[model samples]
Target: MDLHQLTIHQARDLLRKKEISSVELTKAVLARIESVENRVKAVVTLSAERALEDAGKADKALASGENGYLRGIPCLIKDNMCTRGLRTTCSSKMLENFIPPYNATVVEKLEARGMVLLGKTNMDEFAMGSSTENSAFFPTHNPWDIERVPGGSSGGSAAAVAADEAIYTLGSDTGGSIRQPAGFCNVVGLKPTYGRVSRFGLVAFASSLDQIGPLTKDVRDCALVLNAIAGYDPRDSTSVDCPVPDYTQALVPDLKGLRLGVPKEYFVEGMQTEIRDSIHAAIKKLEELGAEIDWDVSLPSTRFALSVYYIIAPSEASANLARYDGVKYGFSYENASSIWDALEKTRQFGFGPEVKRRIMLGTYALSAGYYDAYYLKAQKVRTLIRREFDEAFKKYDALITPTSPTVPFKIGEKADDPMQMYLSDVCTLPVNIAGIPGLSVPAGLPGGLPAGMQILGKHFSEETLLRIGYAYEQATEWHRQKPPLN
Candidate 1:
């Protein structure tokens, strides 16, 4: 395998055995980026020089007998997270030149482990769109087929991994941003329970729904990355101060006694037949591994997830994004005739169409006369959705569904139709609404396009989800199949 294609554990083993230097591995990855980045366009900022320097330091530490699972590994992250001295544009012109003064909590933890940072990946502007097409710079293409989107707003993160641009990448999921893209690109993506990971440095899209997780080559790598980043942070008020288990321990190859449920609602009438068939195959495979399959389960309130998510997420986004005024550190319109005009022009020109649309939707939802009708009602229904999941968990260990209703679509397939684009995440937004954990793993290739099996669990049940994902990954050859990059 190419050095860039090595999984985290594979690289760790080689690095420990002194068979490959960190510099060699880092260079291989950088070279891979140089070769295919033009075709994939998954990267936003490339920190080649700094990454090499960090790799050199890691090599010296290894020579001195120091050890760490990720010490010499290099990776990329979605551009939305704060990285000190590095541009974190979130694929938006508003913060095109913005450099954070301090690192996000997760970045700090990775740095502490001596992990090399390859740089930042692209995303939907302010993470508002389902396709990376909404990026202010360029759309990220799927490695499987360049004409198709990789999925978003974490498209670049998943695409980079799919294209072997990085060993693994970090992506934030609000409404299927990570999982949908992972499904499209054929990777392992997990959205941990809302408070399981710290959000101190994540640029907020929807504060209550956003959670950062890993996009990896396989389920084991997902667990390894999660072990490194999942923990409580006093810096984030919403962060839960719970103990984070070593996720690697949950990688048992059997589902022996677990009860995995399949909600019928997820198998919608109009979903692509390929996805529906692939998920059924995954169910059969899990059953072979000894998992008790509850083939007919109900989470009826899930039908309203897209609606509730649209209202609640945008409402939170409107408030969270208000900080990007012209007067602050972001883009400023120097020629504006007045303060309000400057603010208006700065945002007007800085944000993309999707961002503006969501902001308007959110603002309207929270407006004086509409609050009780739209925002309040959505929150109330959000409770109903969560309650339904809560009730389901009482009878089952985990829930299963397709990560998305369809495979990767053409770059502009749904770009002009907002509702069609919104429907892309129908299988996933409910997890965010319920604030639980969800894992997306490659199940099969339908029409030569990837389909993901999403495993959902109760809050803080990431270990169970990881266990389930790992078992599925081991039993199937799907994750082992790399994209053809056609």
Candidate 2:
């Protein structure tokens, strides 16, 4: 068997049986990376040396009978998460060489559990775009069809898993970054409820909306990764202090008696035909699996989510990103005549077009007079959106929809049109706006690209989402369909 293609659970069983060593597994993964990294451009920094050393340590530990689920497994992380000594560039030129002095909380947690770190994957510069094309480095190609995008800004992480470059990978989602890419690449991606995972060392995009989660080959593997990373951290003031259940316990094969709502608003007009059919088929499948289906559920406030997200996220981003003024860390303009010139040039030379666009939008929204008119108004709508989901959950266990409105479009298809690109996330922005947990599972391959069924649940209701996702996954062959990469 190709070791790189094995799931985390499969690899775990073999390692514990003394059938395969972590070093060998790691090498297989690294070799896979070497063979495809050029074509896919999925990785930003490859840490083969560090990965081998970590694998060697894991092997010794496993020899002593250590059986941590991730002990001997190798995985990739989105470059936005700080990894001590390794560059966490956010695929941007500004912080191209800005290595963090400390590892992000999630990184520390994974390492503490004996997970082998393969390296950092690429992302849209500062996680700003719907396609990975915004990366200051290079666009990460979809493994399914290199001419198409894998989705972004977690594009690299999703592409890596689909290509079998690593067993699994971590991704951050502000508004569908994880799930959109997961759908595009035919994998499973989860965005835990805000604060479900620590973001202490994460390079902030939109603080209120950003949450780190995993993109994995299947629902069970997603559960395993969530079990390892979901928890509160003292460093993150927003991190929730709650008990994390063994997510594996939630992965039962049926969704019997669970009430699932199908939001009418989510099936917006102009959506691709295959996408609509796929989601409808998913809803039908859920009904067959014993879920009580609510076909006309309406989240009225959802109509305003896109506008609210753009305003609020950019406002937060403008505030959060104010630190990169060329005086502190990251890239600086040395030829500037003075501090003001240096600050101006640093951002001008460092940030990509998308990043600058968002920054400017945010700056304008947060400006003194516009604050109440734009940012405040958006927050009011955000609360309404959240309340709508809250009321829906009173009658439903989870809500279902399509993750992306369309399959992975060809690269550069939406590049020149920012509005069209932003609309790519129309279905998913509501989940983040409500600060709820959402999961995207491969639903079907339409027109040779993948469409995903998005499962959205109440805050901290990840287990329920996983239960529903796991059930749907096991009953279908979608997750088993590999991309035509090889």
Give the least accurate 10-residue stretch of model 1, judged by summed lDDT: 477-486
lDDT of 1 by residue, 1-486 (tens): 789999999999999999999999999999999999999999999999999999999999999999989999999999999999999999999999999999999999999999899999999999888889999999999999999999999999999999999999999999999999999999999999999899999999999899999999999899999999988899998989999898999999999999989999999978999899999999999999999999999888988999999999999999998998977688888799988998899989988899999999999999999999999999999999999999999999999999999989999999999999999999999999999999999999988899999999999999999999998888889998888753
Q: Candidate 2 residues 416-451, lDDT tens each?
A: 999899999998889999899999999999887999
Candidate 2 stretches with Cα past 4 Å from truth are none
How high a TM-score does candidate 2 get?
0.99
C-alpha local distance difference test of each model: 0.94, 0.93
| Clashing pairs for predicted structure model 1, backbone only | none
Error of 1 at 281 (Å): 0.7
Q: Model 2: clashing residue pairs? A: none
